[model samples]
Target: MLRIKGTIGDWPVDLTVEMDDADWARLAQNLPVNVAAPTAAAGATPVASAPVDQLWLAAQDLLRRSGGTEGPQLMSELEALAGSAGAAKGLLVRLRHSPKVKIEVREGVQVFNWVEE
Candidate 1:
């Protein structure tokens, strides 16, 4: 299980998405418009396993439309995506809004640890 975690504004959220390498390759090979390819890796695991790019893209898209507004709407969308993925066992989201947020990812059901300010 691969996890994709991040914040939408002042809300910290985590998303668990299936990390199907095949699917990731397929998707990456055929990434949609405006969707940048995941960071390149030379190892057996393709770039799809890294959800940071996707999360960042999604956040940027939402923020671009926020008109500089800061709130929880983006966080809500991220949470919905996590639930939609149907692999999240637990999640921790904190809103610190300290001009920067921290993100950490690891193996085993993926871990998304971040502080949202």
Candidate 2:
């Protein structure tokens, strides 16, 4: 089951979706899989994967290249880049808190700008 509660244009929204096992399997099939196994040398601890770091760098680059991007559009692109809505939202939250990024409201829409150091 998945529950989404939010507001759209000042209107409240509550949604719930239930899925069976087969539905879950189908959903899983569409998700990206990290197939690479972690490896370490003898007596060495396996290092944690840093795909999020790479994604963060890429997200910054995207903003840098765009100069400034509208919030919704940027989120759509980020979702595509991150391969998951959760990851994309996480990146968006990080960007919101990043000192290198500036957020502005224009015509009631958010615009994210990259602050070059």
TM-score for all models, in order of appearance: 0.27, 0.59
- lDDT of every predicted structure (CA atoms): 0.39, 0.73
Whose lDDT is greatest here? 2
lDDT of 2 by residue, 8-113 (tens): 9999999987765455445444444322333456999666645444566677788889999999999998888877787677667667767789999999999999
Error of 2 at 50 (Å): 1.5
Those runs of model 2 whose alpha carbons end farther than 4 Å from true positions after fitting are 1-49
State the local distance difference test value for candidate 1.
0.39
Write the residue-wise lDDT of candidate 1 on 44-83 in tens digits.
5654444534644444444444433223343555455344
Clashing pairs in 2: none
Q: Give the clashing residue pairs of candidate 1, or none.
A: 12-93, 96-116, 96-117, 97-116, 97-117
